[model samples]
Target: MSTQTQTETFVLHNRASPEPVVHEPAQEPEPELSPKWRYPKVLSAGMSFFVAGVNDGSLGSLIPYVIRSYGIGTDMVAVIAKRYGTTFAGWLVAALSNSTICQYLDLGPILAVGAALQILAHVLRTWMPPFGLYVVTFFLASLGQAYNDTHANTFVSSLRGAHRWLGFIHAMYMAGCLVSPFVATAVASANQDSQWALFYLFPLGLGVANLALLGVSFWDRMALAPKRRRHVAGMSGGVAAESSGKSALMEITVTLRTPGVWLLSLFFFFFLGATITAGGWMVEYLVNIRNGNVKDMGYVPAGFYGGGFLGRLILAEPTHRLGERRMIFIYAMLCVGLQLVFWLVPNIITEAVAVSLLGFFSGPFFATGISVGSKIFAPELRSSAIAFVFVLGQIGGSIFPALTGIIASRVGVQVLQPMLVGLLGAAGVSWLVLPKDAGLHRD
Candidate 1:
């Protein structure tokens, strides 16, 4: 009953029991290490941009050829232009659908939907429907393209090294653009009436392929990139505060309030409109105003898209290194000079080279805006912020392309030369409005 007697007996009972209760060091879970190569998802999403390039660029090549088959005047052919504008505008209004649906539905599936719609659009166009039916199908197709574009851009912004991804993805778009002219032109050369349908063959194949790739790549796509915590403002002074609520509306509100956002919007507004208008109409302009043949006009648009593709590839590094703002100024200046060349030059050789250079340099401006927006906005609100900015560019793409049709209808597509000059000039001026370091955020 003594304390020593009881303690000694108890110690002996379990002293050799259970293998001496091995003293193992507690294992700490390995720190969740990010992959050495960051942002493979953003790169995966860049494929969509390649799809877009094929769509836009090929369409430009087919426009004149389609005109001959439809037996429509410049004014009537202008309906196609109008539909593109409306489609983009509709998507702009519907931009929120992406973020909303993405919260539940997988983003990869949504991209598949877009590719499917685009393929459907091409099929419908290939069938050579009556004028009315043609317009309707194109609209449906464009809606899908818009969805893919908005979602891909938003998705890329969430990844690490979003700027590089943004540039590369957009460059792929230019690459598609570069190829479209050649593809459509070649097809048109072979078959006159329904030859435009041939252009769809490539897009259809690619779309399906891309959809399959998206399925395989979804796992990697869903992984979150490293992000810093958001800083909240408080009444006590500048200090860390509790996290703020997030929503598409809140993101839009925050982005809209920033002067940089609006200014960037305006910059895109003019540049996007100008680029789409110029590239879309350039072939028709050459055919109608300059008496160039369909094949030759086809080559002309290629110049622009070719330049654009190169610009995207080459400018990515320099722009990132030299600073986006400075690079933008240089691009704008180059665009202005190129537009002048297009306007003043009498020979096709001069005009072709100039247009290509113009497209090449101006390509950077749009990609730059997306990259900057990704940096300026918080990751939580990124989808909405990018959607807001993209809508502005879509509006520009819609409006200006339509305007080119109207102007080309009456005053002449030749007038586009001067208008492009003015628009590029305006974009240049607006680029300066962005405060230096506006796009730099250490996320």
Candidate 2:
């Protein structure tokens, strides 16, 4: 059932050697990177996702305490929430900009910049600032994340065993999310007022670690850089000034004209929305509606992320056997059922189980879509496609979090369960329409 084939090998003999040197026939570019086991690249990328997960999960868990510390109303908290949310928005812009610049620059430098930004932003957040400063700092940090994310997705997807690698990266992120609640809570319990600041230390450390790893691993890997071609806009022979203006727009026009990019973007829109909404809302829902204890509430989100790890481990081979389309649809349907169980049931334990099941089963869908996009688009378009989809997904992430706040402010946190069901349903529909062997398409 495997779509993969063993490559043919050719033996070569040198004048100095009695034995032949065998070289395997180079295969079509893999959907993942060469030497996928290159430990450093994997480690760096995993830490990146991990930092993201921890940041997201801890911030959500810390929201109540932050509101209390600032002596602000829930409305003021929402305004502060924009600071965190703007990071994602800035990520979108960075992705687009990186895609254009990747033509002329190495992805490593871009990622390094992002890591530095995260360290600076987190440091600023820990120092206690005005709401506007908080938002601006995160936005700047998020721009860096966008660069790292798009390049990382592109780089990782170009390797072998993509599903497993993607899963590992995402699982690390979940692991970060899983750990954050406990860390944040333990800190918060001690200080009571300024606990959120303590959580920044972890990402600050990770950001530094990632910078070192990236410098060593990819410092000289620019051969893998996206190819750049110069376009001339003169009409046979024209004043250079007249042609310069038009060529600038042409760069953006080329990316916008690709159909495959737009569809992939739509895919990311739904997928990221589902992920962020679930991660951001689940703990709050449990604590608020189920009257779950804050000390115990840490486990609920961990369970969700734990489920993600399992999904990644179990589904990698099966997805290859069954194909991406069928597997995605199956998981999507399963998520819907799980969400219903979380919603209709009133028991906290049962809700926790359902939420975890939902998180575990659903994590692969987002990572898989990225793999699919890698296969479906041309290499020239791959990062841009990734950027397009990722941006849409973040837009979804932004909208759902803000919406959940509104809903929680009005009807209650329990609304998240039912609303989540609808979102998962939409994701399944999107998967159904996704092209088969999507990664194979030349366009």
Candidate 3:
């Protein structure tokens, strides 16, 4: 054969038996950068809760001022104003957001709206509007809080070391609670003219700062349509892959139907009822029943929240190690003992100490509940489940305080002790009914 012919034949043979092309598994298109748990983002979220804590914690100390300024009684403030106006409205807005806008948007805008609402509410309070208008501020503030907190919680729950983060965020909340009383008390006390309206200035400033932090940390996710999971041709896995294609209504329905949801909600309902009742009414209870001075007893709620700060910080690891179920029951029993001491103790200082101890034991209940809920629900349904549980818990928070106020109006604030004991007992029982392994993977 000629050399040219041989070369052609060799080339053809090589061409016919082509080498295998090693396709590097098409590099997974770098995951559309989802918002992550950078320290700044975490701190901003924690600060949102801090703002909420300041609002909630100050209410107890300010209740006396509210009552006096508006010429309303405890029943009106607790039930009509706080329960319906603030707690109920706030949770309703939060529920609506979770079911609708949250499905379409990211955490940034939701938190911004929440912060704005709180600022508006505080502005109204600073003006000391008519009795009717004053109540509306509570509704706005609560709604804002619910919106900010619900999203912040869902975000934090998805991160590594979620338990510790949850505890830290809640501890920040308690820290806000601890600090708010001193400020609210001081502001309200310093104004002898009963113009405690100035106290709202403190939270107003915090609300603005909260809005600023959320804006900066979540800047990337601010746009509603862009941030949503878009299924690219190759990037199909992880959360986006598992993302439930179901409509928001369907997701909410599925979450509602879960037995674990109802059980957890029940536990939180009673738990929050006790918590809000103790914190909201303790000042009035001391002033009326124990003959505590208004100025001094105004700071009592701080003791309760202070204990909560310590408990969540100190007991988070223990609660996880010792078992959530076991630790909560023990805490309830301890709360009962402390309540008894508070009830029987005649001295104001002793009552204050007892109530503070009650707060300490009760502190871990909220963070632990969130930790457990995150573990139990399916990933897709987690947000709805948490929001449902939290809103229902807020309902309990509203109901018990309202009921206490009503009864106190008729009977006396002395009834707070018995009401707390009953609520705590109910919460413990509810916890018993939850399935041991309720998460989607377990089922």
Scored by TM-score, the top model is 3
Clashing pairs in 3: 90-143, 376-439
| Candidate 2, residue 419: lDDT | 68
Which clashing pairs does model 2 show?
A: 31-157, 32-157, 32-158, 32-159, 33-158, 33-159, 307-360, 308-360, 375-439, 376-439
Per-residue error (Å), model 2, residue 35: 4.8
lDDT of 2 by residue, 1-443 (tens): 00111001000111122111111012222233334436677778777777766776776677666667777654444433633367666866775575446544566666677778877888887766776786677687777677777777666665445556666776777787778877877777776345567667777787788778878776654333333212233334354333433432454566677776677666566666676677766767778878888667755777887787677656655665566677778888998998888888899989888878887778677677776765665554566666766676677677766676676777887777766887888878876666554333211
Could you give me the TM-score of model 2 versus the true structure? 0.83
- Candidate 1 local Cα displacement, residue 76, angstroms: 3.8
Per-residue error at 362 for model 2, in Å? 0.3
Query: What's the TM-score of each model vs. the native?
Result: 0.81, 0.83, 0.87
Each model's lDDT comes to: 0.64, 0.64, 0.75
Residue by residue across 1-443, what tens digits does model 3's lDDT show?
00000111111112221110011011221233434536677798889889989988998998998898788888788776656555687787677557566545656777788889999999998878888788778788888888777777766665555667778888889999999999999998886687688889999999999889889987865755332444323455555434423456676788889987888888889998988888889999989988889999999999899999888888877776666777888888898888888888798888878888888888888887877776666655666778888887788888889999999999999999899889988887887776675231121
User: What is the clash tally of candidate 2?
Assistant: 10
Worst 10 residues of 3 by lDDT: 1-10
User: What TM-score does candidate 3 reach?
Assistant: 0.87
Pick by lDDT: which candidate is best?
A: 3
